[model samples]
Target: MKAKVGMEVSWHLRMLLFISFASSFLNVSYAQTNNDYDTPAAPPPGLSNCNGVFLTYSFTSRDKEYPHIKNATAQAWAFKSSATIVNTGEYEVKAWQMFVGFQHKETLVSATGATIVDSDDFPVDASNGTTFAGGSQADLKTSIETAGDFTQISAQIDITGTQFGVKPPGVPMPSIIKLVNNGYKCPKATMRGSYNY
Candidate 1:
């Protein structure tokens, strides 16, 4: 009778141990699955669901001795540059405004195809950068059914006093360029070759 009682208690203890170990293993698996669901999945590859705006700033030429400067001792650098804005999305962007983050203390001598917003003069203060809006072409349409040039605006800007002071093959592009339109969500700019999209 004593031996039988001892065997029964031992079987009960073994069962209890097995149940505890199995439950712990199951809980760990459940927690891992729950965590996988909690995290957000990555976006699809080559997704183009949002409106797209691409800007290209090209450095045409640079002159170290700018003839416009009154002070001969002060260093003045002139740059002939052009900026192209392209709308590659499906929708039309009306009254499109662009922001140029020029950080080289440059001033705009003149600009065509786009005008400075809230300012009429060509000698706008662009030392800290400036915003531009379409002058005659104020709307950017979809790029569908386009051959060479899509719905785009090419602005030729003549600037002086860049103070960039860089060597050859060094372009004085802006630090950032963005589209400032109401009710539109712009994505971060990505570098492609020498342009930002």
Candidate 2:
């Protein structure tokens, strides 16, 4: 009876340990998943533009330590026509695009420099440069002034976080065009239509 009881107790202990581990693992996974893709309740309020560029990473609700930045990701877009810069309106439509992404940090993690990817050209006198980095930040004004003619500026917002030797996750395309309709200086800025990836 003692031996049988001991065996039964051992089996019960094993089962108990397994259940505990499973429960703990599930909880941890849930937490990690929650941390990965939490975005803002509403897109952060910014001055929307007609020919605008948006650089975003995956995971909005990130921890304080790493914040909203990840590794291994990309972005890209294209515009239909040119936007004239001769008016003084709140904002106008200057550019349109479809974006695709793999992985993006939910928040700003680091301010390290990234490779500039762009292909936009503006008139010398009426130029307001724009950067078209695949899925990263771009100096819009500087980019417009650099092109030789009307063209698309392409760039890669590379993530070089050494925390895990990983770049932000690869964000696929399909990120749509966002209008910068507010805080614009030109009244006649027209937005070209969008082209797909």
Candidate 3:
């Protein structure tokens, strides 16, 4: 009778240990699933042009985990710009050029000291208008900034474009081209204001 009781107790303890281990594994899996990365937000408003072309610029930064770095979280920033151009004119446009500029500022704070990094006038080109129709959809450009580790990061992006219609073979270039504006400036405007993270 004593031997049977000892065997039953041992079996129960093993079963309990197995159940505990399984439960812990399930809880960890659930937490990881719930903490998936988030999608980026939409670009700000007022980044359109007078010629029915819309430009959007967005910046995002987040904390990332690095297993190799102890007691340190990596900070990363991403920048993107997209342009949608609609001819909306009576005549088809021959060519177009989109100009984009970006600036990034970063500050790092650690036990030693604080370090700052500034980058200005980084140019990105996204120009294409080989054959544009009156109501056709066109993508002008897309660009992404580098990511790194910093305590604070901020960025500014500017976008502008010029459209050119079909000109006679002998006509000068500038005379046949049209400049697009967004009420703020002529042929140039702010696609995205200063964004901080």
The TM-score ranking, best first, is 1, 3, 2
* TM-score of predicted structure 2: 0.24
What would the per-residue lDDT of candidate 2 be over residues 5-36, giving only the tens digit for each residue? 99999999999999999999999899888954
RMSD of each: 16.8, 17.9, 18.5
> After best superposition, candidate 3 residue 129: deviation in angstroms?
18
Question: Which residue pairs clash in candidate 3?
Answer: none
- Model 1 lDDT at residue 80: 75
**Cα-based TM-score, every candidate:** 0.59, 0.24, 0.27
In order, candidate lDDTs are: 0.66, 0.31, 0.31
CA deviation > 4 Å runs, candidate 3? 1-29, 32-39, 45-53, 57-97, 101-188, 191-197
- Write the number of the candidate with greater TM-score, choosing between 1 and 3: 1
- Model 1 reaches what TM-score against the true structure? 0.59
**What is the number of backbone collisions in each predicted candidate, taken in the order shown?**
0, 62, 0
